[model samples]
Target chain A: GAGVSQSPSNKVTEKGKDVELRCDPISGHTALYWYRQSLGQGLEFLIYFQGNSAPDKSGLPSDRFSAERTGGSVSTLTIQRTQQEDSAVYLCASSLGRANYEQYFGPGTRLTVT
Target chain B: AQTVTQSQPEMSVQEAETVTLSCTYDTSESDYYLFWYKQPPSRQMILVIRQEAYKQQNATENRFSVNFQKAAKSFSLKISDSQLGDAAMYFCASKGPSGTYKYIFGTGTRLKVLA
Candidate 1:
């Protein structure tokens, strides 16, 4: 009955540092996704993981953004060498399958790079 | 290229009234899906309604309904009996049929409900 959940609702880090955001998808959900939400902007796709298949990293803005889902459940998105432009909300979502029409979203982590 | 557009950045409606949020999208795939998601101050994306490309009939969910114009590549959300709780940011998204379910989202429309 629980929905998707993310940790560190808010995170503040200095420039050039590294930070990791966590996401716990719904039970039995085999598909997970990450997105970035800049202030006053739309949601930008980040990365995706579906079952045991290779994750889709095309949406990732740069090599600094990487994510991995272990045991097919929890996912962690790590941002290396954070910059001020990285200040945004990181959102995670999950669906029953990779092509499932509907996706359930998490509360999101508000990351701030100073 | 797949793209969703929300022309209206903001809209206002009185309580118990009706308001329509416009959305249009362009894609090469004929078999696709459109969705409307609401995001309140809580920042959680909640599905409001969805429409399948093959379905000629509009999709309705309680007070929420969509006008799906396939030819025009438009899917607009019409909210009736608007309530204060319905006030939030509405986003229009479109996704292809296969490969991945990643959706192309619009900039979003901020709806303000006046009591």
Candidate 2:
């Protein structure tokens, strides 16, 4: 009955550092996605993972952004050499096999790159 | 590429009144899904309603309803008997039937419900 969840609701890091955001999807959900929300940009899809298939990294702005889902459940989005432009809310969502089902979202992590 | 548009950046409605938030999208695909998500101050995205492109009939969820016009690529949300709790940011999103689980979201509309 639990919904999607994310850790470190807020994170503050200096520029050039690396930061990792975690996401815990709902049980039985095989599809997970990561999106970034900023003041300038609305909500932009970052990556998507379905079961054990290769994740969709097409939306990654640069090579610095990467994500991994361990055991097909928990996902971690890592940003290398974080820049001030990376400051935004990182949101994670999950759905039931990525069909017509609705995707449930998490509270999100507000990352501040100073 | 699919694009969702919410022209109204903000809107207000008195309690128990009705308000309609406009949304339009551009997509070459004929079959897709349109959704309305609400985000409160807590910033949690909540699904309000959804419409299937193939479904001619509109979708309704209690006080929340959607006017889906496939010809115009328009999907607007109508809230009746508005309540204070309705104050939140409403986002319009579209997902293509291309088997990719990506959703394109609009800039969102901030709705303020007044008593």
Task: Give the best candidate by lDDT.
Answer: 1
How many clashes in each structure? Answer: 0, 0
- lDDT per residue as tens, model 1, A1-114: 999999999999999999999999999999999999998788999988999999989999989989999999999999999999999999999999855667999999999999
Interface RMSD of each: 1.4, 1.8
For model 2, residues B1-115, the per-residue Cα lDDT tens digits are 8999999999999999999999999999988989999999888999999988889999999999999989999999999999999999999999988475789999999999999
Q: List ranges where model 1 is wrong by over 4 Å.
A: none
Estimated TM-score per prediction?
0.98, 0.97
* Complex DockQ per candidate: 0.72, 0.70
| Candidate 2 Cα errors over 4 Å, as ranges | none
Cα lDDT over the full model 1: 0.94
Give residue B104's lDDT in candidate 1 (0 to 100).
91
For candidate 2, give the lDDT of residue A100: 47
